[model samples]
Target: MKLTTSALTPDRWSGEVLALGVFAGDDVPSGLSWPRGADAPLRDAVARLLAHGSFSGARDELVAGPGLPGRCERLVLFGLGRAQQVTPHTARRAGAAVARTLTSGPNRRVAVALPSWRVPGPDGGGPGGPGLDLVEHLAEGLSLAVHCGRWNVLPDRFRADYGSDLPQEPESVELLGAADTGRMLSRAEAFTHAVVLARELVAAPANLITPQRLAEEAVGLATPGSRLSVEVWDEAECRKQRLTGFCAAAAGGADPARLIRLHYRPAAPVGPPVAVIGLGLTYDDRGVLRSGGAVQGAKKFMAGAGAVLGAATALAAVGGRSEVQLLIPAVAKAAGPGALRVGDLVTTASGATVELNHEDAHGRLMLADALHLAARLGAHRTVGVSALGLPVAAALGPKAAGLWSTDDGLAADLTAAGYQAGELLWRLPLVDEYDDELLAPFANLRAAGPPSGDGATAAAFLRRFAPPGAWAHLEITEPAWSPRIDGYYNAGATGYGTGTLARWLCTR
Candidate 1:
């Protein structure tokens, strides 16, 4: 969107709705040191709402206020609790809250004002407020807030402006703070576009975004002028390479499996060669079980794929120098006689026999093959993304992802990246003991097992496929999407791991 800056004023502003930021320690000063309390309109407004007392900003706390008769067409006053604690993430969250609250209303245009955050300097230099970085975060939030649906253009969502069902949201966002915000606007727009691309991938429906179509997308991304080179291993190629684990998971589906790889070779590759493998399950029906409840978000089974793609696109856009191998083992889990059943045995490319005890756990199976492929290709560092365990979501809550890593350096690198991207990650253990749970009596490893440390068990299974100390597994169950809006997210198919991986790679 067209992003700019504006200073909050009681008169002569552009927008149907205006959002003013109120800080927790904010108050209308009686001592007229600033330009208020004597004859200012802002002071009058504050005096009118003195009894409400809810506008005191505490972190993660918000309070709404009504617009004045002449001041605001519609105004929302949000909290920026304890100025000292405010970060880019919390600021983005505030922006998200405004977007969620406004989209439901008839208001077509909205603007969010950023409150000056207290950045205390060392050696008694006094607390300084926000600058360009703050504006970037605000714009990032507005961009993410408007993201709600998939790749399709639905005619049913027509707006009155176009006299059609589809109308772009938050037509404009003026990050009302500083005057010269040109650099901030540029940074925010680029960041927002990358994140939204990932969101669209996650939101795409399973029927439309099948394995074949996903492969086509990777091919499409590899344009003549682009630095990325795309390759697809069709069913035959997968068989030739002995990717049996991936094939076993795709046996029942009418749509065949694809081992899609996007290699990004910069002119001068820098840092360690990194490989990111994502689970691209078009529709996860879970073997022969046909219960409706079983496949609720099976379409979103491709969340990890979206994240890796998003990261790749972002890195490309920024001209990053990392030699990255992006891989997605795409498949659809269909329930039928031909599908992989319990007690079936398959051998992977690494010469490890896999026992299919729990036939529905295709994420670990496909990721196993992809990780082995990355290692075989000589990836110095490897990262895998998937929403493998529902129990991880339960154990870790729906706020942060559960991370299991074989290396401290990789874990720390990814964790710092998540922080930079405003995504949260909690490091969970890939316990040595959990490795025993995956061992199969009849084969090298059982495909699936019980619920005790199931998240770790899944990671442990994939760890076998990758070289030690070079791999990190992110069980990204929480950041996928929920039914309603949460912090920095509007609803439906959040582009979670996209930012983390992208930021991590770029910074490295």
Candidate 2:
């Protein structure tokens, strides 16, 4: 999309919608007033709201102008919710509200009055300090909201029955101020491009995004200047290596599976390498092979795999000269007689055995193998993306992802990035007491007990295989699968960790 910055005069721009950012009290910019035609209607609305003396200005509203002279069909005014407390998150909501409203109208062009924000700490001053940083974040959220999957074709009957009209593609966006619109657009475009690739990769027909397809996707990333490699192990090869845990999980599904090892070596390696493992279950239909409703807990099942692709996408976008390895154990944890049973015992790639405490816990098994592979590849830090469960949702709510790690330093970096990106993450401890229950007679890892909180217990399970001196990260599952729509993200896959991983890669 084309993005331009100029001394924006609302009347000069004729689009279906125009968005304004309003702050509490007198914080709203006086120089940012709309055109005379746009002003009358807004003034009337403001007067009415003013009538309600209790209105302290913390909410925004969209208004239709009944075809005013130079005003667009609608104007979206966003409330900064107390200028003193106005944050990057408020900017995100403002941007998203603008995009969503514009999408509803036929107007292909839109302009936004960028939200004002406090600059970085001492590194950057407050008000006068890099005020446009919020604009960058707003643009990012808006772009992510408009992203659609090219490959999620509904079944014929479902499409005919429930398909709703979606918004038209926006042709251009206009931002006020002499700020660096070019830089903001560049970053937004790059992020959207990665999201498009990720959505397409995840939305690929289950068959096309299978173990083999995952291998191809990784190989494709390694074409010319990029250093990428894919090591594929078929069923026979997996058996030879005794990746019984992974195999047992895959055995339940009808599709053949493979353990995909993807390596990305930077142009010139810097510090210790970082490794990421993604759970690649192309299609997550739980009832694939099971009998009377055995596969009930597969809701949002494909999210773990999708998060993995997102990690790779983030790595590819922030393509710096740093070494990173990504591993994905692509499989569908379908239940069939051949599948690993709840009480079955299996061995991990680390030579540590694990009893199949829960078949649905298969994501951890693949991660275990991938982590082992990462250590073998000599990675100094590691992280895995998987959807844990609703229990963690109970802890952090839908907007936040649980961040469990062994290293406080890495967690600190990621948590800071999460706040900057308007993504929520809370660091939970990896307690040794939780790992006691996982010990099995023949297995190196086992479910200690019913998960206290999915995020904590799942991270605990992963810690069983974590190598010393390595940092391991677990993404709370709900936020990743959250269907909540903010300004730009419509109610499907949020692509949550892309920004976190990107920031990590870019800054670190």
Candidate 3:
């Protein structure tokens, strides 16, 4: 969908649908600023419609009615909750609600008039009124919702199974009161493309997206003349670099492992380069082969790698002063002849030996080498995103990802970034007590701990490879791939970490 901003007032806008957002207890048409005599008739019509309909301006509430005689074909009023509590997230949800309500209809053009929010400045006090940030987020939600279901069907699916009717995506979306200074639209487009790319990569079937394919995708991100540059490390390079853990985890698959490194060097440097490592198990069937459990959604095991690539794409598109490096140890953890057996001891590049007690705990093995490489490469800080453990999902539920960080400053920054990006992150303690669970009989560490305290133990295991007080880990499971439609996300890959990483990199 094409998204643009306009200075046109809601009443003067000629479109198939006009969406007006009002905060709770301020449902009157005059709550929104309008020209002197422009919206009188539209206000009267809305007032009559409000009187007859039970359209309280509660959160997510929406009501529609016929438009004025010769103006828009439909007038949509959506609730924005409370004025004081309005935020970028609120704007995003409101945008999604409007898009979902109109996209399934015959409307081809739509206008959205949401209230402006007075966001607090960095120091917590300043005249930071509604501007590019709000407009960008609003556009992100609308575009995401419109394209959420576009890749639900596979290429080889039968035409009958794909269905003939699809939602009618709008041709154009106009932010009724905002201005297009060019940056707003570009930034929003960048974010939308990033999230959509991440979602598509994660949603693809395992047969279509292998480890080699993932490396190719990373290479594709670094187009000619782009700020990003990519390098792929094959098995020989991995062996030369002593990436034993990465190679061992990838040994089971017929396709060789690829260590994808995407570097983004800005025009001017800000701070030291920060490295983001993502676990890239393209297909995980360890549960099915080891414990006889179903592996229906194992393809989503690569969500973290998808997020990493997506963030790289966005950061490259929206140039920033911060130099960033994205690392993905792409592999597939399928059961085969060369798969790591129980009691197998693997020495990582960090010189730490790990006992493979649990064959399914291979993601951490791949990440161990990547984290060590990041630290060895002089990264100021390192952050790893992965679908690590079930205990984390059980603790944090589906709405949030579990966070464990060695540094308080890094943790706070990441938490703030996640909140701003509409991704919830719950910080968990890096309890040193759980370190004992990772001790191996012969090796320096064990792959998995006992069933209890597994989440903390998993984080503790990874901390060994990274530098002290310079690393953070996000253990994401269900949030990466939603089982049902939630907010603007459809029932598939949610592209959880892309926005968080992008926001963090840009702000840093």
Best by TM-score: 3
lDDT of 2: 0.61
Candidate lDDT scores, in order, read 0.70, 0.61, 0.78
Backbone clash pairs for candidate 2 read 96-487, 145-488, 145-489, 353-443, 353-444, 437-448
Q: Which tens-of-lDDT digit does each residue in 155-251 have in candidate 3?
A: 4331233242333578898887787546877987887788888888887777778888889888888887678999999988999999988888888
In candidate 2, which residue ranges exceed 4 Å CA deviation? 7-16, 27-60, 66-74, 103-105, 115-132, 148-165, 196-208, 223-231, 237-244, 283-299, 451-455
Name the weakest run of 10 consecutive residues (lDDT summed) in model 3: 153-162
TM-score of every candidate: 0.85, 0.83, 0.92
Instruction: Judging by lDDT, tell me the better candidate of 2 and 3.
Output: 3
Best by lDDT: 3
Q: For candidate 1, give the lDDT of residue 317.
A: 65
Q: lDDT tens digits, residues 1-508, model 2?
A: 5666666555456676666666556433332232233445555543443443443336444433333345566655565565555555666666666565544545677777633433343234456554336656677656655553223322211112222334444887777653655766666666555554554554345655566766666666665654566678887888787676677667877578878766677677888888777677665554233324322234344555555555555566556556877677888556655866678776777777777776466677777777777777788888776654436667677778877788888788888777666677888778987777666777666754566645566778788776566675756456654454555554555666666665666566
RMSD of 3: 3.0
Off by over 4 Å in 1: 6-15, 28-39, 46-53, 60-72, 101-111, 115-132, 149-168, 179-184, 287-295
lDDT of model number 3 = 0.78
Model 3 misplacement above 4 A: 29-38, 117-133, 152-167, 287-296
